[model samples]
Target: MESALSHRRFGSSDLMVSPLGLGTVKLGRDKGVKYPKDFTIPDDKAAADLIALARDLGINLIDTAPAYGRSEERLGKLLQGQRQDWVICSKVGEEFNNDSGDSHFDFSHRHTRQSIERSLDRLKTDYIDIVLIHSDGRDEHIIQHEGALEALQQCKQEGLIRAIGMSTKTVSGGLLAAELSDAVMVAYNPAHQEESPVLDYCARHGKAAILKKALGSGHLISEQDPAQAAMHFALSHPGVTSAIVGTINPEHLRENAEACQRALLQT
Candidate 1:
């Protein structure tokens, strides 16, 4: 099979990206919360090695969020000198304070600006490749969040972000976002096929559709053989430009890339 990373293009952006993007949600959280058993959060050095390895293997797009504990900061430290070559996508609207406390969502213009600034400081980058509004699939929130949307547009105009998008959990929310934003990151997989029509709608409007939870948040890939099957199903979807997979293990990353190639061939 050919290298899946060679399969590129993210929406209408000129930036070419790997079909399998790196998701950094786990990187910011404590291992206990993310995984049931004992799992180690890799140190800065180890994480840097993983980042270097991923780039070496041709994986370029990295998705992270401020809500993910120290992920943006850790990735910033790991990719210190070579940030320009990769596409860094981060989300705003959610904030993580303490591990024990409930997380909060603030999509106001003030909070949006503050969130983007904090992310930039943590990422050590002047401009983010993409900044997505992290919405939890609530129509009321979308309808009431005009200020945040305006702020995001302002940020784009100011050159703080290359593209604007929304990360949604529902097909309707994704469709709504696709109508307003330049791209969308949605939970899309064979297990949840309802979002396919939304993806197609996004494609028709020239908006990029980025797949999240492509492996059902690790459930689909809990077994060895099924991992490839799940990934193939995701990449084979015509509406998806790339599928973001989260894994600290380099071998699993390679498997995802291979699965993408198989999907491309079959499609």
Candidate 2:
């Protein structure tokens, strides 16, 4: 029988997360997404069902952020009784202004600290498993000038977050994030392999590397199912700890999980 993929220890953190983390961007916002297709936002019940399915399929890492519409709130409610079953990861520095259908980022110390506090309250939890900086493509500046990293490190020290990381966008930024953070999220897909060096560095340094947009953000060019190929590519790299993919459809969830299983077998 096919089963959910195995887990990996996330960097130096105590968190042992699933190899395929469920990204919750579509759970909260569908208005200004980069998905090739558009679909209606799922109701709270639907969201709960998908989360339940994920858990049933052995997905333990749930990735969310303030920029992902009401995902944090929805997850707070949907996962009320089963909080311990999953390791929740959220982000700071970016906010989705639903009114304007636009986004704004604030990496100041005050905002960074306040956002973590707000996330705690919204998620109905006392602590977050992982907190990453939601980079706005300006990864280096955000990591340097902005106080986001300091705030996250402070929160980590205070026990507000178990681990600190950055969703970096560049090779240099990824390397820097790995040097400073316990985990670093990078974009890697079959079409692009430029970021492989970052992954290599992380592997050598014992830092966790999380892969984002592994399937080209669901904009795959090939007609065949890319789930297996994407998972293969993601896990093929020794540095990658996990791949985060956002999908609301149950079929996609099953397909992705099975593909991860097959990829693991191949490896």
Candidate 3:
């Protein structure tokens, strides 16, 4: 667990997170859009052990969403009282509607409220450290659903969330959210650096820029040396406050932490 990796400030929020955060989307049973055959859902005990290993390695940020099947519930049951020193970030505006057999986004205020309550219940927490509006690059969906953003703002005012952010696929979507929200989480990496401008905008506005899909959804780590190079490339970006990499393996977690340290040393 001992390494040279250290913590950094998470944008304007008072919370400080490790450069490498845990992404729990894969922990969920339902893998939307992607082929189900590729999904690897970890057992509850294995997931808990992974979290404990990450904590021991000095990582404190855990990002999950209600749309991610049973991930929240599993995290709740595993890391409940054992993890008091962690920062948990979850997203609203999306849900796993079993009737549709797919996840759907509903930015309605009613859905937002329900999503937050459900996330709280599943996470077994009173307040979430960060709440993000998960948008999949749909302008019409976002413009038509102003109430969802307003609901997040209201939640921030009510102290249900420490900070509000937008998770989107496009730069424009992220930029729009950066202007309206407290932080922005977007897909960023060496191969696809289209979100650089959005990251700069977030940096200028004092909003956190969280990098998602940092390894291009496991493409970067398909090989050994490339994985380290990809991690270094993502963390080398000045605007990225942290990179959330999905993995339930403690060995991979340790390797990623070492990669971050290597990146720091190289810089």
Candidate 4:
């Protein structure tokens, strides 16, 4: 029994993701985060339970990255039984050291291919639903000079990735990425609206635009229900395919989903 909310499609890609994808950053990395409060990473049981809850709540998209502590690995194990139910979005280029909490990125041909293969192994999946270049603020340089984008295209051709995109930093880079990739993840919230141009491009082109940091990465703390407002704003945009919101707490996850439900109903 799939929730109707899971049936929304992302442009021409085969990925029919949920209108509100669940972000798994809090599931993996707690350090170097923008969350207002500190939290211990959930244990394996808790993680598995949370994924199950998300599915029951009609969320089909799960965003993960190697840069997140062990999110891919944990999901690999936790989501073992029903692989078809999820549209998992993983990343390349950035790898975080668990012990040091430090990160390094590589977008060369060799590394990009190697990283995707490793991601497939870690995710315990035959093919990843989406693979985004986790840009390090050098969005244009990475897309133009680096071999990552080319590798992703090759992977798509080889049937390893369903779609390819970039979690872009700059507007120009985002526009370029929208031109080249299947999707683009941009940071757009009420507090920051710099990426509207990118959203506009995606809408105009029928490319998928996934909004990240919709709640300002937990920094937009005010009493006016910022989470609801942010989700509404992100989805209200014609270009936005879905809003990715991450939370470790089951209660918070449900609350966020309710907010998304409200947001979707508004239009």
TM-score of each: 0.92, 0.97, 0.92, 0.97
Q: Tell me the number of clashing residue pairs for each predicted model.
A: 0, 0, 0, 0
Model 4 misplaced regions, further than 4 Å: 1-6
Note the residue pairs that clash in candidate 1. Answer: none
- After superposition, the stretches of candidate 2 with alpha carbons farther than 4 Å from their true spots are none
Q: Residues 1-267, candidate 4: write the lDDT tens digits.
A: 333464588867877988888899878898887778889998988888888889998999999999998889888998998999999999999989988878999999899999999999999998999999999999999999999999999999999999999999999999999999999999999898999999999989999998899888888866888888888888899999988888888998888888888888997
TM-score of candidate 3 against the unseen true structure: 0.92
Assess candidate 2 and give its lDDT.
0.90
TM-score ranking from best candidate downward: 2, 4, 1, 3
lDDT of 1 by residue, 1-267 (tens): 334357477778787788889988667776224443455667777687778777876789999998888899988888888987689999888777746645778888988999999999999999999999888567336635556777888999999999988888777777888888788888877687878877889667778889988888766644456767877787776778888888888777777777777777788
Better of 3 and 4 by TM-score: 4
| Candidate 4 local lDDT, residue 231 | 83
Model 1, residue 244: what's the lDDT? Answer: 88
